[model samples]
Target: MNQVTGAPGTSRPGGRTARVREAVLRAAGDALVDKGIGGVDLAEVARRAEVGKTTVYRRWGTVPGLVADMLAEMAESSLPRARTGALDTDLAALAGLILKTLADARQGPLFRAIIAAAASDAQTAAALHRFYRVRIEEWAPCVNEAVARGDVPEGTDAAEVVRALSAPLYYRFLVSGDPLDAGVAERAAVAASAAARAGVYA
Candidate 1:
């Protein structure tokens, strides 16, 4: 029997099982970026990862299951959002990081693939939703800082304000087909800040 250990999809103690699982997830992400969700195949992914088809099927059980685990791994690897002493700067930094990730040639396509999958699949959609929720929680502190500085009203809807910072970026990424301009981050921060000041976020 093989040992089960390590991060969800990474090598642990350099074991074979860990390597196999990591390979599957990595292959899944690559397939997502290259072929989109409909094109991802467990057998093909196993072939790409140099693992046996039985191993891939035995581990993830199904395509949606594999995607869920892949999303879980990505969420785990993501860095925590910024939280500088100042809300404006913190938000700008957070948006900047988001913009960078969304603009990356590889990462951006992978994320777009995930978003496209979510629009059509319930399981995938739920996983993407959870990913964003975790991200929102990570960035909510910036809004709390604004409240502390009296720049925004007390008990402001931190999550909502945080969401605003990324909404335009998503708009550009998905629909607008516009460049994620450098000033967009600052614009988002300013708009969120103003909304918070007017008690709109509360």
Candidate 2:
């Protein structure tokens, strides 16, 4: 786990405290994207956010701690899973959401930078894992729903199915450099869904 939220004088979950957190996180994201994780610092984030440096230092004790909190914030801010009553539509919606996030101008590079950092930093890696765990758990229910509805086999691994749906998209974003589009996202959904139906994940 990361450091605690803050020291004394921290406000409860709204109002000025939330605004300050938002500003600092936005600044942190900007720094991460513009100069990579190596270039991020509490002071710089405070300056960018136009908040007091002491606030940042007190709230987040270290760089990894700060990164962890940033990821937690991201998880909290993400949209909830689709309960569209059909696996195909739910999977397609998730794939489209992943596509939009990975292809975004700011989010793409930011993720790239953070992923790179996670390769070397254990704390960042753990944080990344937690982030994915939250997201996967959020979407995994659709696979379970499919199983219940007989759309896929019984005992299909829900989290694996969710991961499988995003694997190719991440491959394109991180390795293959393939173009990401609505067509590609749809294909990924179709492929993963087909595989699940065929017991590939059973």
Candidate 3:
């Protein structure tokens, strides 16, 4: 077994693998935030991580592979959706979380860089798709619970509900360039809840 660090059973090189991987990931994310996908270089990442170039190459295989692994790591660390036992509260919480994440100074720019990368690279696009899918799956349970509670009718598309909660935040992040306030989360939840009841998600 790879002796682990930072959350146990998550390392491959004694207690240092997790730290080394996190360093590389942070370096890669910083590079992406500062220079976009076009500027990410494994050697530079190795230098930033103080790890050998061969180590990065051996672990990730290539740039796309590294990006995929980075995204997967992010998924592993993502917060679980709250179970408020009420559609409005649950969705509001979800929306708030989404807005907050998208508004994060480092995370936002890194994600935008990843989005740009996805536009031109098939592998990156696939990675992005997988990332979103994982997020949707993680949040879908709340919607299903809402349906079971009769807050929304049966057959509601749970993934769509989750997407609705995230949409406006992403829009404001990508376009409005405004602060993602609590008001946005409240309104988004309200809107999504209404739409779900109206069978928009059916």
The deviation in Å at residue 119 for candidate 2 is: 0.6
Off by over 4 Å in 1: 1-16
Supply the global lDDT for candidate 1.
0.79
lDDT of 1 at 83: 55
Better of 1 and 3 by lDDT: 3
- Model 2 scores worst on lDDT over the 10 consecutive residues at 1-10
lDDT, candidate 1, 1-202, per-residue tens: 1221222232232487767768888889899888989999989999999999988887777777777777776666677767578877888888888888898887898889999998999878877777787778778877888888898898799999988878998899999998787788778877877777899978
Pick the TM-score winner. Answer: 2
User: TM-score order of candidates, best first?
Assistant: 2, 3, 1
TM-score of 1: 0.88
TM-score of 3: 0.90
Error of 3 at 45 (Å): 0.4
lDDT against the true structure, per candidate, is 0.79, 0.85, 0.80
| Candidate 3: pairs in clash | none
Among all candidates shown, the one with the greatest lDDT: 2
Tens-digit lDDT track of model 2 for 87-153: 9999999999999989889888878988998998988888888889889888999999999999999
